[model samples]
Target: MSASVTKMVPAAVILFGAMGLGGCATKSYVREQIAPVSQRVDALEAKLNETDGTAKSALSQAQAASGQAQNNGQRLDQLNARVDGIEQRMAESQKKKPRN
Candidate 1:
């Protein structure tokens, strides 16, 4: 019985050691599991950068359009003043003319 017990002890130790080592993750296995997630994160970052650039470009264009609109409004106001002066002169000339 003692000889059998001694033999079983070493076999049990070897079996437990193999199970413990098998349960541990290797470096290559960890890299394989994480690679896809890393690639997805990189892709999302790139897309975010592209979107940020587009938003900035749109804001710049809107600001430029707003400046042009203000310039047009000022020109329209100046033209309105000139037209009013011409109308006033025409009215005065009509009043000075003699009836046929």
Candidate 2:
């Protein structure tokens, strides 16, 4: 009975030892598991940088367009004033003419 009990204890120890090792992850295995997630995070960071640059460029373009629109509005106002002066001069000339 003692001999059988000793053999069973050794067998139990080996089985439990193997199971414990199986449950623990190795470094390479852990790295493999995390590789895809790390790649996705890196890709997202790159996209964020790209979007930031594009947004800055778009903002500058919008500012330039707004400035051009303001300049055009000023020119239009000046042109209207010149047209008014011309009409006023023509009216004065007509009034000065002899009655027809």
TM-score of each: 0.71, 0.70
Measured with C-alpha atoms, the lDDT of residue 45 in candidate 1 is 100
- lDDT: worst 10-residue window of model 2: 1-10
RMSD to native, candidate 1: 4.2
Please write out the lDDT profile of model 1 over residues 12-100, one tens digit for every residue.
99999999998999999999999999999999999999999999999999999999999999999999999999999999999999879
Relative to the true structure, how large is the alpha-carbon lDDT of every model? 0.98, 0.98
Off by over 4 Å in 2: 1-24
TM-score of 2: 0.70
